[model samples]
Target chain A: MTEDKFKHEEDLFCSGHRACPGCGAALTSKLVTEATGPQTILSMPTGCMEVTTTPYPESAWGISWIHNIFENSAAVAGGIETAYRSFDKRNKEGYMNHEDVNFVVLAGDGATFDIGIRSLSGMMERGHDVLYICYDNEAYMNTGIQRSSSTPIGAATTTSPAGKESFGEDVHKKDMPSIAAAHGLEYVATASVAYPEDFKKKVEKALEIEGPKYIQIFAPCPRGWRHESKNSIEIARLVVETGLYPIFEMENGKITNVKKLKDRKPVEEYLKVQGRFKHLFEKEGGEEVLEELQKIADSNAEKIGIDKE
Target chain B: MTEDPYEDLKISKGAVVKPRTTLVNKTGSWRSEKPIIDHEKCIACGNCEKFCPDMAVKETEEGKFEIDLEYCKGCGICAEECPVKAIIMEEEEK
Candidate 1:
């Protein structure tokens, strides 16, 4: 067995918060907090994590945390970073060094891909030393699982339900990592909660850099995705193994590293496990939809040069 | 005593409250399934201790893994990751 790589000194994200059983977002938040450590201040937006973990008079956070509106976590984090920097300039001989502090914005897919994209883009453009992490659970799970732009094609969401005429969501998942890389950020990566070691390494690497960094972590939702709670990690791993989600890192708008799948599984293996895709199997003309999804995965594999012999 | 809810907001540093204050809320009742550790068959691999998202699994002084039921959400990641199959998830007794 591999050595325990994710061991940390503190449980920065403490238990007793009301995250659902087998919540990938909660787990990812914990892993991220552990990697960043106590010197960090987190700016969270309104979402499942924000609502669940932070009820009044009770908070799961062990570090300094601020909750912003749904669409302004990045902007708020930028403001906080500026405040710290301004204070540092005024107090040169002070006991604290502002450079030692880390500013982070943790938001969901709805905030990142849709509502808060403008502020996030602005933060990156202004070159704030903040790490913006989007825990992409696909749809808007907090707001009753509505279809967000990050929701993959053919997934049945509340807003885009499968009917006699429609076969679930029509649009594809947004290429958020590439979009972040396009902003010319110093660091951008995609990770999954299943791969804790890789996720931790990316978090640590993002903190070392001095500019804006974006990391979109694939956090599977058990309730939204309609999967057994125990199968969250299995589904997370399957998405990567089947080439549906490419785990890679970018530096200065260039792909610096890619985790290539040695033996790729068919996309069916992943789609078959989720309840959102159960309709795709039970309905007529569902195989065609599955083929189209496979094409998307295959194209991704080709684009990342993972399909090369 | 009905204290002002926004009293902390008046502070200079934007309300730096005490950390880990959530410890007051015991979430043990939230569990529908509970993880039972088989001590005799345990190898103390620490896989269960490491993968627990809640940090409810602890290593005792004797190096055996034990789950603190007060906080364990019973996600079963430990049972799934246990290399020795020493941990089992059973339905919580009502």
Candidate 2:
């Protein structure tokens, strides 16, 4: 994927409101809009990206956008696509038929995984021509860094605080790609802000597919995860290498391709860097948790078909 | 479905919440009903309780869970993550 293909003259997620410095969600939105172009209509849900970009009256989004409650973004996007198509079908001269106009839904992990899964599943099952992009910063950063269904096990969130007898967010993140693919949707993929070119390519691929498309983006939340803003890309890269978040895609219900990986690191490398996981190492029995995390990573590498080097 | 070998699988304190279908929770008056659950099945899994953006689900006694209908936006995580499928969401016309 070339950089030019993902570059745009107009910024969809502008440089104003309040996203933490070097916010990965911000970067993902920018790249998505650039790839999808300005004519896109964004169906946003309540989350960090939504809160940060649209602070009441002011908004950083440059495209036609609508902020719906957290769970119904997919439903709203589906309806918008239906409306757009119906309008275009009635009028021959209507500008709505332009290929640049993408009916896209931008949602967070909480919205996508736990809350919106039903509608999201419904949208895919219905085979609507919409793109659902989940910018996963792990925890629900908008609501004070609480745990979300997407919060990986052993990671600390407000709701899943590290305590003597507790393991943080015990369940694994719902595998969105697999779930969406199971619906026999045209496309489902994973991307990260660290790889803008790859991320843009995945968006483009989703557009080419006739039915619904889902892209779960691994966005870094520094404040919530207690990391420096500058290390967003670095940490994102580590996430992939560690197998915590593998970059891959599924077409229909079959695995088509997996991204290249060379230097595989222990999950502890990724965990040790974040303060959220600090307790897992600093606490008396934290090392055991780190070992458990390693097992999780190794298993994901195997399941996703990421060849060990 | 096969178990996700990656999960830590910590069972929270209390009776395991039984998973229910959408049909079970249907109340005629519900504009939307958020499932308040039994924490025993919860394992403090943080599945349903975690993603609730409205802060609806609260851990009461050691292993108990309750849903605050007042703040709930009607996003159904409690129903979705009930490992036992204990909770179900019902939307009734208001």
Which candidate leads the pack in TM-score?
1
Backbone N/Cα/C clashes per model: 0, 15
lDDT of 1 by residue, A1-309 (tens): 233222222468887778777888988888888799989999999999998778877788888899889999999999989888888888857535768998999999999999999999999999999999999999999889999999999999999998897889988888988889888998999998878889999999999999899999999999999998878888988999989998889888888888887898999999999999988899998888899999999998988866536
lDDT of 1: 0.87
Poorly placed runs, candidate 1 (over 4 Å):
A1-10, A92-95, B1-17
Question: At residue B69, what lDDT does model 1 achieve?
Answer: 88
Q: Is the docking of candidate 1 incorrect, acceptable, medium or high quality?
A: acceptable
The top-ranked prediction according to lDDT is: 1
lDDT of 2 at A274: 87
Q: Where is the poorest 10-residue window by lDDT in model 1 chain B?
A: B10-19
Q: Residue-wise lDDT of candidate 1 within B1-94, one digit each (tens)?
A: 8998987876555444456666666677788899999999898988776666677787876777888887888888889878888989999887
What DockQ, between 0 and 1, does each candidate earn? 0.35, 0.01
Give a tens-digit lDDT track for model 2, residues A183-238.
88777899877677889999988887677999999998878999865466778878
Give model 1's TM-score versus the native structure: 0.92
TM-scores, each model vs. reference: 0.92, 0.73
